[model samples]
Target: MGRMKPQTLLLQSKKKKGPTRIISVTTIVFGSLILLLFVLSLFTTYRYWSQRSRNLSGNNDLEDFDEDGEKFDRPVYAILDTSKGSIVVELFKEASPEIMDKFFHLCKTGYFKGMLFHRVVKNFMAQAGNSQRVEAAEDWMLDMKPQNELMSTKHEAFMLGTSKDIHANKGFDLFITTAPIPDLNDKLVVFGQVIKGEDVVQEIEEVDTDKLYRPKSPIGIVNISLRRQR
Candidate 1:
């Protein structure tokens, strides 16, 4: 057989390599498509579960004003456990009696445990309270009727306050404002303060939040036990 020309050899090499290149490119493209689909599915799953969880517990009413309303006189300390660190909250009962009473009862009855720190407004506040238990949700929503009463106070650095809403969910989830969102003065309730863990409160506030005020990180209430401070 005549020796193959250099051009012929080169042409034969190109033909052999062409199919390999096509196969490699096809593999890469297919892998990327699969990865993209997996990511989308994961995101969709996460969103569905999150919304379902919020809506299911959203109907809970945490406040029910009785015929004879109760008020707390002494200061109370709440021990909070977040995924980041421990937070010791000091409630000013004198400043906001009803608000503290409501918060106290919620803590005493184990209502705030297992709930997530759902909202975190940077340099403003961190909000939590929504449980996995069906009973907790039922208790929360039992007294959700609208109350015209607006509990307002000075937005002091350590003060704790409930948000205003037609129902209880907004107030049930409490937060501490970092910057004086002065506009919020009339809208939110100032109930307590961070006598000890201002730094921890600020830490929580730094958590990433979504438009709905929900945190991107899954921070939860490890515990919510309170004690009457001297």
Candidate 2:
């Protein structure tokens, strides 16, 4: 007993740490690393979204018809054939020439013939495009690294959504404004209006939607072609 007492005192004097202390220290270090990673991730996301928002105004119209013939300037036209019905959309070259050019090419090639409107928000709008195209656009956006600048256009009725608006994202999909949401004015680009078959849009909206607002049934565009409504 005397010898054991001496040994215990010696061990105490050495200040040996227990398993719990060692585990606690390791956990603290790991927690600090995790916190640092989270902060970095948040900062990166903010910077990405911020860059996308620069030069971003909601008033731009992606396409529309010039009611008055006085303005001869017009953008290229592309007609779309949907399961609901046919729709005609007029383009706007004055607002965005580059985007219009790309759109025209995509249409002429029939790239969006069978694409689906993968996403639809009831009160907001419908979004469609080529899934592969969207991914490619996002990659290009990250590669180019756009600067901050406000678009000098107005958002009308069915203006198209560009990769820039959603952050260097593009696809064959598009969306139509359900009703006049005052808050979206001059913020989202309005490219065109529903020339015909707006009822289809209504029917799509009426269907039961999910949390993301996507409809239970698929809304597919059977075919798309260009036409002059002279």
Candidate 3:
């Protein structure tokens, strides 16, 4: 204890010498470097999240994913084939071109095959995502980041909604509303609507859940098939 104090006092003192002064200078330099690094890291973190917020949740969506803007004006459809039955969804590509494009591609590649309808709330929504599959997904699947942005759309019954992280980044996680969700209108992007098989959505929501809202028997996606109506 006696020795430790003297060393701390020495560090605080302004006295100079050969080795002692050199050690003191070195300590000061190291401390200054640490502070600089901390400040830089804070700035960098802020910038990275700021840019992501703008890109992912801001007013804009990634440009018409198609090179020639082809998919933007079309009527894109996604059929979620489940154990209960098929739910046909009419995706609003014109409103969410980028999100629809990625959804279409993911459906085409069977990315959501056998994924559970993990969360179901009666008269609310049926939520699903191949989250565990994404963790072990190949490079190509990982590269197809599910980009999203909020639109002027509202959450009505049968509307498809995209999921967002705390950072407001979008992912393949998705939900379909079986009833109007007034509170979620500003939080999640409404990407599509169930045009057929509303009964299937209701049946899926009838699934029993534990405290975690997960279905007891594990209802799941057989696969999602995509098509466009011209």
Task: Name the candidate that leads on lDDT.
Answer: 3
lDDT of 1 by residue, 1-230 (tens): 89999999999889887454345888989999999999999999999998776554322222232213455444556677667777777655454555656666676566777778765656555666542222432233343333344433464455666755515554386666665444455556666666676787777777776765566778887777665542
Quote the positional error of residue 74 for candidate 2 in Å.
5.1
**Model 1 off-target regions past 4 Å?**
1-73, 130-153, 166-171, 210-213
Q: State which candidate has the highest TM-score.
A: 3
lDDT of the candidates, in the order given: 0.61, 0.55, 0.67
Alpha-carbon deviation at 166 in model 2, angstroms: 6.5
lDDT of model 3, residue 49: 86
Write the candidate numbers in order of decreasing TM-score: 3, 1, 2
Model 3 scores worst on lDDT over the 10 consecutive residues at 133-142
What's every prediction's RMSD, in angstroms? 20.5, 21.5, 20.6
Which residue runs of candidate 3 sit more than 4 Å off their true CA positions?
A: 1-71, 130-153, 166-170
Location of the lowest summed lDDT over 10 successive residues in candidate 2: 54-63
TM-score of each: 0.53, 0.51, 0.57
Ranking by lDDT: 3, 1, 2
Write one digit per residue (lDDT tens) for candidate 3, span 1-230: 34667777787665554454345888989999999999999999999988877554312233233533356555666778899999888877555555665666666567888888877767667778743423221322234322243323464688886754412444487778776655555445677889899899989988887765667897988987765541
Clashes of each: 8, 23, 0
